[model samples]
Target: MSIAGVLILPQVIQRGDPGEVVHFFGIPIVLASYTSSVIPMIVVVWVQGHVERWLKRTLAASIENFTTPFLILLILPSATLMTIGPVTMAFSAGISGGVEWIFEASPWVAGAVMGGLWQVFVMFGLHWGLIPIMINDVATLGYSVMKAPVVASVIAQGAAALAVFFRLRRDHKIKQAALPSGIASLLAGITEPAVYGVNLPLKRPFIIACLSGAVGGAVTASGGSAADNLANPSLLSISAYLNHGNFVVFCLGVLISFLLAFFGTLFFGIPRSAREEEQPQELSEDLDSGIPAQPVPADKKVVDADAQVVPAGVVVPVAVDEGNTTDLVAAASGHAVPLSEIEDPVFSSGAMGQGLGIRPATGADGSSDAESPTGAHPGRIVAPISGKLTAAMNSGHAYGVRADTGVEVLVHVGIDTVQLDGREFTPHVTKGDTVTAGQVLVDVDLPTVTEAGYDPTVITIITNSDHFSTIEPRTGIDLAAGDLTVVVER
Candidate 1:
């Protein structure tokens, strides 16, 4: 249908009315003028999925094969022409008219509003509402101006992620995570990973990206650019703009948005404190010695507390004795809660492993502190046990630490936070890095978690429970970071 509309239909229309009726097998068939449209085809195809299932259930195998094809090829198309086709066409026309009115009223204002709020809509899942309008615009008007500005928003997000990746160049773990996410957004028009993982956590980059996207959107709208199809707005989909004369303007808009966001974030998005905190440390000649020098085996003898200093202001109450019990500290200060009270099934059921959940404390007024520029609920996930960081999610929502004595702990922040990607979390240490008791693992934004409709309860579990003789929990108590929360006995 698309090929015929673009190639053969124009010639056919030049000769005679494309909608003229013709007799076939003594039956009148009214030829559709807008046969190349998208909505009617989509509606027909959607109805076909349901129709095929009903046909299979009602017909016998011997007769079904022949009858099904007849119904699908003849009856279905006729029914679509008589019913679904006209209805969808009318619907598309209405939506196109409405959007055209909005754009015609004030192009630049419309562009700025749409581009700036597009990502916000995505965060709350409201962007799905715009999909139909975009599809309708192409079907009714043969092109859509709405999506041209959206391309700017998508590219800006990717540029912001790249800026963060460069800013944290020394942190291999963060670089590993940010680079791929950035590329995905820039090339594929998928911005969730970049928005939630890299930009939102930092705050400044996300704001700058939105502003830059607005500028690009205004420029594209002022140039009267429109996309020829409903394809996602990404670099790879630039071909959609070729049908219109504004391809160059679209390309220029995308470039401007990307560069503006990249430079804006690189200069001002990352905080000075974060830079100071993440500065590279001098490495010893023998890298194998590791941070907080490897402890002597329990069989060798007990290690003194003074000799083993905790990192990042974490306090270890007991001396290191490998054969003896190990204390797992509370990663954040909060009201202690039972795992059963958590909203998520995986954590509440204790199926992920035996653990305790903490409902993190908010501001002094018991309200969220998310309005602060740095974010609300400023707290760090401290190292629960003196061990090597074995696994850490790039999303910053989860971490796995393995003690020298073989006790493995999984500290997961927020129930279902993985959905947010990495919006409100920041990792201080990467996987495989040796960490001491009280070392800051990740910093979390609790208010952002709550505002996103997720429970801000952090769960700490002993993943390798079989190796321990007993796993004890300090429940029903308000605890601070590095406070004894669990005891793992080998």
Candidate 2:
């Protein structure tokens, strides 16, 4: 109805001069065009969703399906035309014009701020506010200068990823993921891979990329580079700039963005842990691969000369009950499972060390017996080893214990349970507290965790498993608090 020749609505006809008019029952109509506008549509859809929800809740069940549609179809469209359309259009246009004015008046500040905060805008959905303006600029002016800065932002993300790849030494998995996301960002205009996987996870790299993007955006805008057509910003789409924009300056902008981000990340972005070399990867994989290394018979001498960290310890009877060997007890009773079954890659991939997962057992009333009145909350997690409580979150979801033997253990209660804000957790100890084996750390309420849509599995991880000679986990069985479960031989 808004476009010159699309759907011909009733009573909405082309009158004299000032365009189309809706002459309905002598009512004064505001003929606001909804032609390729984004804000008005977004506002309309949002209002529709809220109205539908309210109607669904207020209507009687017998008449809900039929009567709800009747009311929506009857009342919403007319109300929208009279209310939301004009207001949203004016609001959107004002903001768009104001931003354009600011940018035109101060190109350097505009370029720097827009380039640096583009990723932040995407994160919080503020980027949607600019979509209509960019589209309108293309539709009305045949080009858009606003998008030049954004293209540099994408280039910076890829550059940061590539820098992380080159800087990383220990984790081959991160390197493999980093290289691909970087390439994808440089070739195509996809930033999700680099943004989520590489740069954002490695905090400093993201900041460096943003700063580099700001520099590049300033150069691109000030040097008079613009896009002739609205194309996805990438190296493959650079041809679009060749027609009318300064293609040479555009190349220079991207090159500067890439070099700055790449070098900045290489110099200051990588963390010390990522660069530190670790034990062979295969040793950790053997724990969860379901193919155990051939165990030597009780009497035969087991040889582990080729093992990277320490000798594989699966000897018999006496268990060599001596030196450097540390025993880890179960934090709570549950059905034990292998770490490979866990959803979080940090623990599942053994990146945080050898992990053991235990699904909490539920009692009669959907809650764990740990919450029972007996005061003997068996579901409560205890310190696995007598060590200093090094890390205890205020949220009471996880705890870290560092033993004198140099073994570090992290006791995590449930996956993503932190979102509950300690709703089902009770912390018994704080950070820097010296705890004994079997001492209660955090009492868990399994039912609340389950009801809140999180996995209530307690996990115990050996943080520095590579430093030890062998880490042996006993899974696929029932566990009890204080029961010896993991054996780490140094």
Candidate 3:
């Protein structure tokens, strides 16, 4: 019975009007298959990363990194297929069974309660639970009371996107994207594209949308209208709802939801302050602290300019050379390789940056001095690829770089490296200094440090490692002063 219910939605939408059609575009192919599921999630993760970068640019601080987006995608799809999908089926069957009992005894009361609770499920991401009953009711019973309220929820969210169209004025780019997505969602059933993309961040509009969705859902429930199939809650599937004479009531519900969310947003909110407005506050604080805001070359933007150190995990090392204007000159000239090819495996999987890793630290021999192993260990850590140096500075404990491709690479040698306390090191560039590929970032006294029993193994990793798709290493024992170590791809 549950399986039958789950299949009900697609059957109705596909069978509804002889003229109804499906279109394949972008990542979400309309074909009914599991294979089609993977790409959309990847696209979602990509957008999430883009949003993270955008936040860094506008706010001058990062809210989160790309890892947050990658994890969200990684978890959502598997759960959707393995857990949420099946659980939804069972949940729908249970609800339908309970509703049937109530309707057999008192139809009107059952209708009222179902209507009220429908939107509640959506707020919790549990509406999938109702899909099966809605579909089965349509196919087996030739109609359903389960699907209609859900459609109303879709309308509510779309209306909320429209709210963003008016509410977010400070950032024109977001507004431009939201307007079209908002309208499309109203006419189609997909809300996540807009929810995660635009509405959620625009703030108050999402809240207004949820409230309106609840109202619209209640209206659909009261009418006892049923959707014929799931069809991903899109407008193209609206033919199923057309079967009922209460189409006018459904339209009315949609209208009310839209108006309520839209007007509520306009009357109650104000535009966010301009970016310029916040800078002086930051600068003022910096001045009061006796530290001034230094101007970095416009090319190298910091990824986590203000992020606290992430709790310790595997601390990877990334080396940075200063730009040519300073000390970082290219060992050799070459066109830019795609960023993904040069990134490490752990970083590539996370879409970070391009760079190379050396398995054996230079001084494996026991005879080497405790601090300085001149053979290749400290100096052995060279630039992964050639590019205009983005940054070169000692962050009190470690040396870091911002590459021309806008990647931030940090190189920390040895464990508890920060404990080196800015001793036994030569810092080549000051803050805001430019460097080139393979330029010496720091001159480490390896033998002296090793004599003190510190492992001079250097860690090189892309700080913004999540921006890449893949990074491959070059096949050679020794890389030229400016030879490529990592190859990157978008």
Query: Which residue window of length 10 is worst by lDDT in model 2?
Result: 1-10
Q: Is candidate 1 or candidate 3 better by lDDT?
A: 1
lDDT of 3: 0.52
Question: Each prediction's Cα RMSD?
Answer: 20.5, 14.4, 21.7
Pitting candidate 1 against candidate 3, the one with the higher TM-score is 1
lDDT per residue for candidate 1 within 241-346, as digits (tens), equals 8876467877888899999999999899887665544547888998767657667886788758797666864545656565778788777777767778888898
Q: List where candidate 2 sits over 4 angstroms from the true fold.
A: 1-18, 136-142, 224-230, 242-247, 271-490
Q: Residue 163 in candidate 2 has what lDDT?
A: 92
Residue-wise lDDT of candidate 2 within 61-157, one digit each (tens)? 9999999878877776776666676687678677667766766787667777777888889889998877677876665456667788888899999
lDDT string for model 3 (72-134, tens) is 455554434344443544454566677656555654455444443554566577766555455
lDDT of 1: 0.77
Arranged by TM-score, best first: 2, 1, 3
User: What ranges in model 3 sit over 4 Å off?
Assistant: 1-95, 100-125, 231-236, 269-490
Which 10 successive residues of model 3 have the least lDDT summed? 324-333
Model 2, 426: alpha-carbon shift in Å? 35
